[model samples]
Target chain A: MATAATSDIKWWAGGRSPFNMEYGKLMMWYFLMSDAFTFGAFLISYGTIRFSQNYWPDPNHVFNAFPFAGHANLPLAFVSLMTFILIISSVTMVLAVHAGHHMDRKGVIKWMIWTIVGGIAFLSCQAWEWTHLITGHHPVLIDGVVQEIGTTVSRNPWGPDVTGMMHDGMQVTKTGPVAFGGYFFGITGFHGFHVLSGVVINIIMLIMTLNGTFDRRGHYQMIEKAGLYWHFVDLVWVFVFLCFYLI
Target chain B: MQHSSNTHSPEVTFHHAPGDSASTIKKIVRTTVILSVITLIELALGFGIYMLHKNPDPSHALILFIKGVIVILSLLKAFYIVGVFMHLGDEVKNMIMTIVVPLMLFIWFIAAFLWDGNAWRNLRNTDAGHRPAKQEQVTKPVDAKKPGGIE
Candidate 1:
């Protein structure tokens, strides 16, 4: 016969947390799970469209611009920076959670600020990339004639790079798959929204910590829950980076 | 499981070694290094694909293989993030499974959607009435007279 401490603990006793988890943390985990599906649907639909197309734009060929490099090609460089920012932010968040575990209020505030800065940095980079794509003058050969067009959801300047025409030393390509821009902007934009909300959440948590909310409660469980959401945002970025920038 | 000092408090925290901040920091540092190294390798693979595209006749299979490798590496990075950074690994087994099992549906989701997309591609390519001349599957109409501008 199992003892009351081990296998005999009544899971449905209604008083104890049967899973040995805080209900708040459990709900946060569930919320993240559902968010995962949202991103999953976006990425999968992107893949579906990509598979149906005979010619798709190579991300490297499209995303090879640096901020101040003046048309110098740097494939995967900017997005790599974005990825590191997110990863490092996730680390700081973990540290914040760790510090919260010890009730180290100063440490939590410090790390939370850094994480917020990182989130803003990522958003700024996204803004620049989006601006570059939308307003940036890209020449493409729509039909048999060359046309100056920037990438839009309905039009992608990069088609099959067959006609080796050059305008001002820049390669003029064909109209690539229109859906490419749609999926790229749609998924990344959605993820950016998540990051935006995450930053907001972290700020609120930071304020609560400053006011000693956890101190009054005697546990930093709120920070822990927020950390899960922050890390989930970073997690989704890993895939978004994969789907849009890398492959 | 009931070994924690606080009995009335329902929050179940994993055991932390008292006065062991250094060791915990060390673990965080190690995981950070692991994550960075994996990302670097992924970027290297991405560059390799880019370099291959420069070739006049790049092997398609090789590119696909590299892409496959990148996806797997992404999954590995995801694992470390959720496990170490998010602290999911420290949670109980059934708790982990609850978060994980629903995700398995993605396998079927990706497979089915991609399968149908490929089928659509095939239908357009092989169907006589709908097929564009040769392999030029221009689903969008070519409005040549409409000047190039943002839609």
Candidate 2:
């Protein structure tokens, strides 16, 4: 049975797959749907906490530093780079999938390499950002004492300046809500972990292509499946970027 | 592969169409450009919000409006990513529904949680929202040593 009875036969009969798609692809879609819920819960909770708080720290103030730009504030520059890298990677993955459909082994290899490279580049940028935030200390006024604090899960030193205080020619503020750091690291870290795994999966796909696995199977549907997964990672980042960086 | 009246059963032979290479490439390029442009607009809007914050007296309503626009643009980006890049649009109607229908829960999920969160804040402000407070701690004794409750 094929699509010949496209309108004649019953689709929900389930004798064969009624989705008219491969079972593997359907399973991947289901998995991505579940993963979406996971991220949705995290972001929604962050929103809830934010609404509950009387005051929240502005993201631009906290994420104002750039790499090697000492004392110069440049908010959203690095993350914008990260976003572009991921989008480019997604485009390359699409190319890989397209080439896979043609069964052009060389084309698939070339694009897959570029896609993996983009993934690593994004990850490297994220690593630098995490290191910078974790290690960069700023002066904060705590209980009438000047203390240096870096952003962590338990501390946020980006609160409003109540007194006319100065340290290193910068206004020293009190600690803001502690949940800020926790959610920032937690969600972004989880997303980074997904990117890492996606890279690994792409690597495996690359090796399989080089080893003639798909050629032997006489189909490149596996690449299509992996492409779905790759694009899904990109999809999640859209929301992540909006929640963390934009609003 | 024809869509005439006498079509196959779409079971084991329902492979996706691989159109002319040129058209396929063109479609890919178009989607890529669209995705990039949307991202650039989103970045511009993000900068807009930052500029608003820099103003001495930022208009909260305007900021909210810009945020709403950004979110709508993000949804547009997401649609391109999922529908074109992931080829979800090429899937069967039932398949797309299967994927999208479950996602509707997020609307309720977000609404309920944020509603409860805001309600919790109101409750705490009104002394747990149950009964009047005792005379003991209605107004705290102002601390002479610590102003603005630092730390």
Encode model 2's per-residue lDDT on A75-115: one tens digit a residue.
88888889999999999999999898888999999999999
Q: Candidate 1 — what's its lDDT?
A: 0.87
Which lDDT values do the candidates have, in the order given?
Answer: 0.87, 0.87
Backbone clash pairs for candidate 2 read: A2-B8, A2-B9, A2-B10, A3-B8, A3-B9, A3-B10, A4-B7, A4-B8, A4-B9, A5-B8
Candidate 1 regions exceeding 4 Å error are A1-8, B1-8, B11-19, B128-151
> CA lDDT of B55 in candidate 2?
95
Model 1 chain A worst lDDT window (10 residues): A1-10
> In model 2, which runs have C-alpha deviations exceeding 4 angstroms?
A1-5, A12-15, B1-11, B124-151
Q: Under CAPRI classification, how is model 1 graded?
A: acceptable
